[model samples]
Target chain A: MTRDIWKHLILVIGAIIVLAPFYMMLSYSFKSPGEIDRGTGGFFGRQEMMVDERCVQLRDPNRDEIAAAAPQYPGKSDREIRDAIMEEAAVACAMRPVVFNYTKAFIEAPLLRYLLNGVIVTVSIFVIQVLVALPAAYALAKLKFWGREAVFGLVLFCLLIPVHAIALPLYIILAKVGLTNTYAALVVPWTISVFGIFLMRQFFMTVPDDLIDAARMDGMTEFAIVWRVMLPTAVPALLAFAIFSIVAHWNDYFWPRIVVTGSRDLFTPPLGLREFKGDADGSFFGPMMATATIIVTPLIVAFLVAQRRFIEGITLTGMK
Target chain B: MAVIDAPVAARTSREVNRQARTAWGLTTPALALMFLILLVPVVVAGVLSFTNYSLGNSSFDWVGFKNYDRLLSRSTYEKMFIATFTYVVVVVPVSVALGLGAALLVNSLGRIGDVYKTIYFLPVMATLLAMAIVWEFMLHPTIGVINQTLELSCGTFLEAIRFFGNGCADGFPLWLGDRDYAIWVLCFIGVWQGFGFNMVLYLAGLTGVHRELYHAAEMDGVKSAWERFRLVTWPALGPTTVFVVTISCIRAFQVFDTVEAFWPQGGGPNKSTYVMMFAIFEKGVQQNLIGIGSAITMLFLVFVMFLTLIQRWLVERKVHY
Candidate 1:
């Protein structure tokens, strides 16, 4: 037990370093701009009220409004009336720092739309990958076919081509087709995951020939067997691959950054956070961190919930 | 290829042909997509690397070896190669070592080590761009948590050290902005983000090491744990080490997300962190210089494929294990 104490000591320190950014991100999201600038407050901030400068700025009184506000203070000069109206605007905009940070995060950018686009792209990519991969994996694993070796060899060859390395031609192709700014450019290149084909083929290799033979005896067509028999048996690996695909495409910033140039509505979470950072000044730090926190929370939460599957999924891909 | 068909004499030729047809039907989509998406890109990049091609241009002159020559001669491209090789060189060994070390430490503690494993793996699971942004904030020169914490050590006895004293008297280093510190900071984050992955792989490798080898080594008078590891664990982990090192190299070579996030303008202070992936993105996608980008892409593919082939060779040889 005493010897174990030192091991625990080292691991605890590593944990602190690993968790530091997360700690900062969450803390900054809660902090007011003043607290963030001065670097005070504990994990969660004091929740003190702060005014939204932009909100108040937009409500700045013009000449006609100051003249119309003469009813409330008939004897007062226009400057005094404007001062009182400005104070009222400030009071009206006052809210807790947490509310200010979160609201501005959504309002200042289309964060929800970005998250939705992230979902759409990742889901469509994974579905298409499975649609294209599973049948080929089925053919490679179980079917007695000519050119099987050549096909598997081609898959192996394709595995050597890192998709990111060839982004130039992919981008050019998308541009040639006038699909550069569309979702098709984001989804099309990744539709064929050679790694997926390779992985599923490996997993399918372990299943018994007798199980597949039994399905054949039931008068099932080969397509039905693929969708029904092999698919069920391959669930554990497929689950891992699903998490793997989602995490990768969801967090993918490069391809989306390349293709989704002009459209804010089409931006993924990473691109949205990046665009937010582009426009943010010092005073926007709280809201910017808030944007980051929201962007990262879903997968982190899912990971904390099912860490085993996430770890297995992530590491399993390295087998390629 | 003929071997699998040898046993098919027992089956009818019609059934065999039916099976082959089904297989072709099933694999055609994947094959076509693979050809278009994967293979054709290589052919395109290879063909276009010999020419000065842009997206909208109708005519492109063949510029044989010029792109490669510029890559060899130009100072900017020279910095790109240096920065890239430097990152791969530093990141691969350090992260692999940290990974193996952490794996050993965590594996020894049994179930209690899972907390550390989970914590370490968090960086891998979370979005790297989001984390990179957070890191940017943390590495802020003035009000960042790192400098703020460093300021705490100002008047302490630790200031007797020159680096810490320099940090104390003057301001702490401007991490991302300072050229001297930028690449190393990026490398540091790369290690921090990536070692967890290698640690996970190492932990998996550790499980495959048989229990009786240690017992056998102990019976053979291996007194220290280091000797046991040197004899039994290291040899047993030979395959895993090769795999971890190769994957780390590929990943290290493709270190773009952090580099792009940190130094989007010119690939860091004076292009100190100008990695190849960023170079491709900058030249091809950003500037529409397809010729240079294709050249860099071809070179990147060669390096990656070469590393992969070496790993495949090593695994096939089973040299140590």
Candidate 2:
């Protein structure tokens, strides 16, 4: 009985630690400045407090200093307001509230556009990667050609080179080709991935040779065999890579940062979030957390929906 | 007779060449694309490292190792090297340990393990940039919830602590802004994001360990758990450990998004947190020194390749499969 109680206690503690920031982000997002001062509403402050009208205008002053100065609202003196704001900030930082800041953030930020770009890029990358990788995977898995292992080995070798190392070179090429500030800049350079090709090849190896032999016996073209047989059989592995690739590219900030210049249309969610921080009052804890909460939700939802397949993908792909 | 014979020979040679050209056609696109995207840049970086090519001006004058010379002369560059090494050494082992422990604990559940897995993997999917934004708020010293919580907990525990007083004045560590603790904070966030992935890998590795080995150990009366692990499971997990460690080290070296998001200027608080890639990024994207950035990137690429080769050699004896 004591062991069981202890086990439950430990689990509860672990869960609290895991959920605390999220809870704080949520609670603070709803809270007014006053409640955040009390540090009680967590992210969502008191229900009675009204949304500051300035948040909806989209023409608010730079938010970093002003938002940090926010605890003075509702008849508080400037000195007291500053102190209160600081104290409230300290408390919010501790609690990690989710509400008031996020509400303000939603009204003020360009979250929707950023999210749209992320979805487009992620989906397009996955679709194209599948099309290219599937054919290459089939050829590597079933073809009895000279230099096959050598080519496969070379593909694996390229995996060691970190993407950052290639970033500068790719940037130069894109600049020369005049693709910067365009969607082509974002999509073209990364169309061929060494890691994806290597992964697909590994997955294709697990398919029985007889399956391909049978398809060939039917006089199907190589492409038809790849489409009809290998592609369908590799669904689970593909799904796994898909989840990894989608989440990775969707959340990616660095590559997009390099590829994109001044065009706001091309800004992905991560970049948009950065712009929000720079533009918004940094201390509007409620809206900031709220924005963060909004930003994080789709990914969390995707993970939950595809949890089983995603887990298999991560585990298996890491295998030699 | 000689001209007729030459025509016959040439026709046969052209037909033979056509078969060779078909083989080349099948292979060209993949190889050409790879070369264009991957190889060309590498070669350019190698060449450009010897020149001084600044952005805003595309003048590429051969400077003959001046960039390398300048870097070697700088104390800051030396510190960056040391700091990056320390980060890799500290983060890789610690993350792997935490990952192994978490995986073991999560795996004890017979079914419905997906619940725990999803919860653990949540941080992995959260945008590091967005998370950094939230964390910046959370780590705020004044009026931040973290400091408030610290005051509440520590004030209750220690007599010296007072609420909103001088000694406990915003108990939150400066995190990324503080020189002493910034690297640790970066490492902590890194471990949190990475542990789930490692745990999943470890779990997979654990499952692949043959059941017969454990049964045989039990039959031989090897009662001690540590001995069983040392004699059987540890040996069984060798390949997984190697794979995990190699990938983890490579990932650690390439860590840019979080550090850049958090610090913006290559590990803030006096550049104490700056790693190799962060420095490369600052030069390329921020400073627009394409040549220097390319040089730095090539240097890092060579370093990673060398380290990977060394790791492969080191683990070759231990890896069973």
Candidate 3:
């Protein structure tokens, strides 16, 4: 059991290295620019009130404003009135760093919109993938078909050509068809998940043929039996495939970067974060990390809540 | 009896025909989408590789093998090959080994290991682009926490090392900006993000290894842990390692998100991180050099297919089904 001490030591170090970036990302999302620059703020950072310089800049008093504020100042000098107004603007703009960072995460860009787009694209892709894969999987597994061997062979071949490799031709084809900058560009190419079909087909093969036959004997059509009998039995496999598809597409940057070039509305979370990094300056690091945290949190939280399933789902690809 | 047999045979033939029809009905959409999306693009890329076809251009001229010629002869493409292969070569083995190592360690720890498993796997779950951005921030030259931390080592005994001494004297390496460090940094990130996945796979494989085997080996006077592992565990993990290595290789080959995030304008300093995936995107999509991009795509597909074929061969021939 003492040998386990060394094992724990090694694992703890590995854990720290692995968790460092996550810690930094979360920490930066909380700290002010000053703290981040100096690299001095501890984990949650000092929650001191920091002025929103941009907001204060917008409120820089003009001559007419100073004259207008003169009355509120009573008999005070114009300069004093201006200082008072400026001080008021500073107070109005002041907020804690945590609020500043998270607010700007939403406000600086259409982060909420980007998040929605991510949901829309990832959901549509998963749903469509399941739809296309399930029946085909069912047929390949249960139904007797001419050229089933050929179809399955074709699938094995297609799996070799990773979609990212052939993205050039796909992009060209999409551009030719005027599908780029649309959700179709994001979702169309992924609709036929050959791996999903292959995995489900394998899973469906393990299912008892008698169950399908029982449905058929009840006068259920083959399609009906597939949806009613096979799909329900394939839930575990489907859940795994769903996790795999959603995670990949949700965090997908390369495809979305290619197709959804013009429209901000169409940008996925990854794309939006990339754009944030693209234009980010030193002061903007806080919001950028906040954006990173936001973009990454959903999946990480999901992974944490259901660690076993998430791991199973992600590694299901390895079953090949 | 002959009349009855004939009717039964005829009825079965009709049923077979009906099942085939239904099968076709079910499989048609998948086949059509697969052909349109997957198979057709490979063919299109094959054809497009020989031509100077941009996206918007209606007409283009064929230059047979010319695009590939550039890929072979040009220095930039040379860098691209160097970078891509360097990433795959370095990341694959290291990550696979790390994964195997981590898996073994975690397996021994029992329930306490689950925490480590979750922590290591966090990188696999986090959006890689976001993490890449964070890494870039930490690797920033002057103001980054890495350099700031290194500066802390200035007055320490650690300064005896050249890297640290140089930092104390001149400056620490600009990790993403330095050609020497850029690719390696990317490789480190690749391992960090990837090994956890392989670890998980190996953990699953471990559960399938018979517990009785270890006890039997012990009874046979298998004295040391190393001997036990070498005799029992390693052999049991053969198929899993094969699968893990192949998957890791394919993943390492497709390392784009981090590279693209790190250096959006060019590949890294001196094109050290110019992986094939990024090269395809840059040449074909961004630069509108479709022919050249398609050429790279063809090469990439060949590499991937070759690896997968090798894995299948090993799985069939060496590993018992």
Candidate 4:
């Protein structure tokens, strides 16, 4: 009993240290700038209505605007009317810090567009990788053909080359073909996932040959068998692979950083967050943390919802 | 009967031929892409390492071995190698040890371990760049939570310690800014981000260890947990340890997100954290020094491949038991 208590104590301390930053990130995202700097707001931070300084400045009433509001405040002096309009603007712009941070996160940058780009890139890459790798993996695992050993050997050799290590040469290739700053640059190099092919091949080997033979007996062509027979049975493997691929490409900053330069339209979530950080001064921490939270939430939510599957998928790479 | 048998034999052979052709058809796209995307870049990097090749230049001079020599001789490159190796050496062993410790501790608890496991693994699931930025905030010198918390410990019994005493008198050390602490800070973050992953792997490996072995060890009078670990648990986790160490080493070598996030303009306060990947990005893409960059790339590949090969060799020879 004593030993168990000691273990729990130590583990709890470790958990606090591990979770501190996440706590800080979430807390900061909900606090106003004043609260964040003073570090005074506890957890969800006094959700007091706060005015956006930038919003107030942008809505500073010009002479014409004040004159236009003269009828509303009849018999009031010009200065008094101007002050009333300014006060109204402040009231209209007033919102909770959480709302401010999240709204600013979306409005200050094209975060939605960046996220869309993230989805497009990761989805396209996964779809294409499945298309390219499934057929090849099926052939390598099940089909008997000449040069099969050599092709499998090539796949194994390609496994060693981490795409990040070879980014320069890849960038050069993309540049030569005038493909940089385009979607193709982001998606092309990753289209051939040697790891995916290798993993699926290992999996395909476990599948019963009788099933495939039965498909062939039903007059299914080899192509039809790959899609119709092998794919359905490879669901668990493919789900694991999907999680692996989606998480990697979604969080990937290096490749996109290398390829998509000067194109905000093509920025992924990480790049967008990075750009936000680059120009952010002290007061922008709320919005910046909000951006970070938004970018990180999707995967974390997915993992929390499906903890077992996510763990299995992430550790799939390590098992080899 | 002989004529019928001949035609049947021919038709079966034709079927075999058709199967072979279809296999080729199935594999062609992947094979072509593997060559183009994976193999060709390696060849390109190797060839370009020997030339003064920039991206847009029409032609380049063949500066044979000059790029490699510069990498060997340059002070900056020396620092690059030093920083990269320091990170890998410090991070891999520490993270692996911590991971093993955490795994053992968690595995002992029946069901309560799941909570700790989930908490630890949160860092692994979070986006690293986002997490790195969060770390940057936490490490802020004056206003950050870390220093603020440290400051709160002043004039207490905790300040009786020498380091804490000094920090109490003077301000706490700037975690990211001080030259002496930058690389170590990076190492700390690397370990923090990575050990959970290793922990999960070790936990999985622990599950695979036979339960009866512990009963047998008890019968053999192995009373201590350490003795039990040595006898049964350690040997059972051999393959997992090899895998954890290799993966940790590779990841440690590729420590860029935190470094880049901390010091985007340069490596760190005195290039103290200028890792190889950053050097590659800096010189190769940023500066257009393709030759040197390619040389560094080749060197980086050699280190990784050698490490993986060593891992493979160890797994084959030692862990098969």
Candidate 5:
């Protein structure tokens, strides 16, 4: 019992340190600027009404507007009319800090567009990887062919080349082709996933030859056998690869930072968040955290919902 | 009988030829892409390292061995090697140890250990850039939770420690800003983001350890937990240790996101956190010094491949038992 208690104590301490930044991120996302600055407001942050300073500035009434509001103010001075308009604008802009932060997170930059680009890039890369790697993995695993060992050898050698390490030359390639600042730049380099091919080949090796023989007896060609026979059996492995590929490409900052330079339309989520941080002042913490939370929430939530699968997918690399 | 068998054999050989054609057709795209994207870039980086190959240059003279020489002799490159190796050397062992420790602790607990496992793995799932930003805020010298909490312990008994006492007398060290603490802080974040992954791998390894061996060890009077660990657990975990260490070394060598997130302009205060990846990005991509960058890339590849080869050899030779 004493040992259990000590273990729990130590584990709980580790958990708190691990969880601190996440807690701070979510808390600040819900917090008013004042609360963030003062480092107060508990977990959900009082959710107190806060004015949008930018909105107030945008709605600041001019001389013509004060004159126009003069009728409503009756005998009030111009300054009083301006003050009344300002108060009304502040009131109109008043909202809970949480709402304000999230709205700003979506609106301040094209976060939705960045997210769309992320989805497009990840989905395209995964799909093309499956398309390219499946047939090759199937060939490598099942088919007896010339130079098969050489091809598999090349695959193993390519595994050592971390894509990030070769970013400069790849960037130069894309630049020479005038493809930088384009989706092609983001999606092209990752299309050939040797890891995916390797993983699928490993999975496919376990698939019995009898299955392919049965399909061939049914008049299936080699291509038909690869898709109709091997693909269904490869679903679990494919799902794991999908998760792995999606997470890596979605959170990838370096390659996109290199190729998608200066174009908002081409920015991935990380790049967009970095751009946000570049211009953000002190008061932008709430919105910045809100953006971070937004960017991080999808994967975290997906992992939470499918905890076992996520772990299995991520640790699949260790199985090598 | 000879005529009939010969025709059938010829037809079967035709089928085999068709099968070979299909196989080559299937692999052609991947092979082409592997050549263009993966294999070609290394060759390009090699050639570019020998020339003054800026992107926009119409023509450039060959620079011979000057780039490699500069990388060897330059102080900036020296700092880059030091920082990169320091991070790798410190982070690999520490994270591997922590991972093994966490795995053992978690594995000992039956069901409740799942909760700690989940919590620890959260960092591995979170985006490193976003988390780095949050950590930056948490390590903020004034309003950060760390310093504020330290201030709370100033007059308390917790200040009996020497570093804490001195900090309380003056102020807490600026964790990210201080030159001495910056690389260490980066290493801390690296370990934090990484160990959970190693722990998961170790846990998977732990499951593969046969239970009857433990019983046998117990029968042999491997009495204490430490003894059992030394006799049973450590040896069983040898392959996991090898893998976790190698992967951690590679990942540590590629430490860029957090460093870049914290110090966007320079590596760190006085270039203290100037790592290889950042140096590559700054000089090659940003400053258009492609030669030095490619040189670094080649060196980076050599170090990583060497570490992986060592791992392969160690796994094949020693850990096979």
Candidate 6:
């Protein structure tokens, strides 16, 4: 074995490319506005500047080193030095310092409230989806019925229409019902995902008929068989769909933007981040990144935990 | 026992039919929800396309194709069509090819396949709205790190030289701002974000391919790598390729967040990157032209359905069980 140096090298390169934007976001979140304005910084500096806790420290402590870094400015006084440092800190904090940005994100905007709203909407949608999808999938896969193929095919066909296509009509309906600016507007319309139904039906077909027959032999009803038997065995598929559903809704911006116009109180994390972009004519880069980090953190954590099942689910679909 | 089972057998058929009816009953709730949430919107959109519906308006004046006529007359609509079509053209092939390439590389490595998959899959998991904002700053004209790096690598002297400076005098591509380059940049970003997802699919498809096929090919004097791929690999991965192509095309057409964040003026800099989805979005949300927006959406729906049907017809005919 020659050790396949090229393979290892390619892997390393792939990893770097994948990590580049993240690394850049993390680093830029720490840099002062002045440093960003100048467009140059040491590759490895203090990472804490990206957070709000270390925002004030963004200013240079070493005047001599500062001069070396930027030879443009030299003289001045004690207070002047302090002001320059403060100014630099402000700018750096402006660019991003993770902690400061987060604090500002929470304080200047109703981010926490938005996050709570997101949680409610996301959870409610998921619960309703599983409830609706499970029984429907069981019937389609296990129970023989008239028009089964036609109905399932229709559901599959629905997947072709992009979400944007229905936004207008959905908005009108929601508006007519006086549901806009409320949680109902956000969650109710998304209760039944066609993709979820299709996915569950597909997975349900893989469940052995013998298992269902065995359950039925024990005097279990169809609903009981679905909830008690099929549901437990379909954990991997459910987890797979969970990742998809969570990511899709979590990152969704346009719908939320349209629906929750009157209530900043009910904004989701993405909407909250958009609002926190620039207020008072100055961009809150530090807080924005902090908010971005916080908003994205849960999704990243979810993926990390369920990665095995997620990959399996995706691959299974592909093979089909 | 055989004599006793005769009556039970007679009842079994009726029992099955009864079970089927109950099953259909259980399905009603989900079907209704789907109809209310998905189908109703589609039907309403179709009906609304023929009316002059807008926000804060009680009456819907029956316009009867006037909205469609008006939209078709607008230059922005034409530009949006071209931009969206171009985006689909560029994004589909590039993304599918890159995905397959990445999958092959990871599959060949064997042991660290999961690690490679995870790294690439991170972007797919990333929050797109937040990520788009991050990219905007990174692609900023003056202070962007990318521009600075290019300047550093090329050196200020080379940048100043007439040969290089003639086309790019501003020293860097105004990636988000320049109309001509914006769509291309958006396509690249879209591909970058999505390639990992399709890679995972291809990787799965590769694993399912029987190793004996390769052995047989090898026995047939297939020494060249391309020949092996053509004979042994391509046919096995047919489903995966069809899947990636169709899905990627559909997704590329729906791009909105990235372009919205990057080119905020609804694809400014001379109406360059104003894609169809964004046009529909702007119509409904920004302009509140509900009827017109509905019209555009119906058009998009018809277009996507037509494309999907054609693809299904092509792929389904060739699909192997």
Model 4 misplacement above 4 A: A74-77, B1-5, B318-321
Candidate 2 segments whose C-alpha is farther than 4 A from its true place:
A1-14, A55-107, B1-27, B112-114, B159-172, B314-321
Tell me how far the alpha carbon of residue B232 in candidate 5 is from the true structure, in angstroms, after superposition.
1.4
Interface RMSD value for candidate 4, one decimal?
Answer: 0.8
**What local lDDT score does residue A38 receive in model 6, on the 0 to 100 scale?**
68
Q: TM-score for all predictions?
A: 0.97, 0.85, 0.98, 0.98, 0.98, 0.87
What is the descending lDDT order?
4, 1, 5, 3, 6, 2
B1-321 per-residue lDDT for model 2 (tens digits): 997899899987785565335334434455566677777888878887788776557477988888787667787778678768878888899878877766666666546455666777777778878777666666677666777676675554563545445436545566677898888877877777777778788888889888899999999998997888888877888788887887788888878777777777556788888888788778876788776777788779988898788666767666564
Candidate number that wins on DockQ, 1 or 2 = 1
| Better structure of 2 and 4 per TM-score | 4
Task: For candidate 3, write residues A24-103 as lDDT tens digits.
Answer: 99999999999999998799898999999999989989989888777778989888887888798899999999899999
Q: For candidate 6, state the interface root-mean-square deviation in angstroms to 1 decimal.
A: 2.0
**What lDDT score belongs to each candidate, Candidate 1 first?**
0.92, 0.72, 0.91, 0.92, 0.92, 0.78
- For model 4, residues B38-130, the per-residue Cα lDDT tens digits are 889999999999998988789999999999999999888889989999999999999999999999999999688998999899999888999
Candidate 6 residue-wise lDDT, B135-239, digit = tens: 877777777766766666464576677745653555677778887778788887898788998898888789889999999999999999889888889888887
What is candidate 2's local distance difference test score?
0.72
Output the better candidate (1/5) by lDDT. 1
Predicted candidate 5 versus true structure: per-residue lDDT over B154-245, tens digit per residue: 88898999988999998999999999999999999999999999999999999999999899999998899999988898898888888888
Rank candidates by DockQ, best first: 3, 1, 4, 5, 6, 2
Clashing pairs in 1: none
lDDT string, candidate 5, A109-202, tens digits: 9999999999999999999999999999999998888899999999989989888999988998899999999999999999999999999999
* DockQ pick, better of 3 and 5: 3
